[model samples]
Target: MTQRFMRATGRLRIIFGPAHSSSLDHEMTEENQRLLKQRQAEAQQWETIRRPDGSTYVVPKNPEDKSLR
Candidate 1:
């Protein structure tokens, strides 16, 4: 029997399944690990500010509200 699994990104869907081997499982694991690393690297490239309360926010390159400045 084959099973299907879907990864969701908001309204977007990524489907990969029906895999039937240990090799397939290993491949999927590697792919997920690679994607996670890529996302971590991308996040590190962005600017973020940490609050004293332990919350964090991404610093916008442009401010939409002029009064904020």
Candidate 2:
């Protein structure tokens, strides 16, 4: 069997720079890292449940859709 890996891919942009400016690193700052971790954590909370009817459904991490507490 072959093993597969999931990767996160994205493009880089300079939010406040000129058109000729260089691109920024994806996870360049502490705040960016924090946000990435937060998003990944939230995504992991989701689940894919399979039913006896041979159907699969995705369930949200917070089924109640509550605010981030």
Using lDDT as the measure, which candidate wins? 2
**Estimated TM-score for each candidate:** 0.33, 0.41
lDDT (Cα, tens digit) per residue for candidate 2, span 3-37: 11111111222433323434454546898789989
Highest TM-score, which number?
2
Candidate 2: worst 10 consecutive residues by lDDT?
1-10
Worst 10 residues of 1 by lDDT: 1-10
Flag clash pairs in model 2.
none
**Candidate 1 local lDDT, 2-60, one digit each (tens):** 22332233233324433343444444568888998888765555578899999999865
TM-score, structure 2 vs. true: 0.41
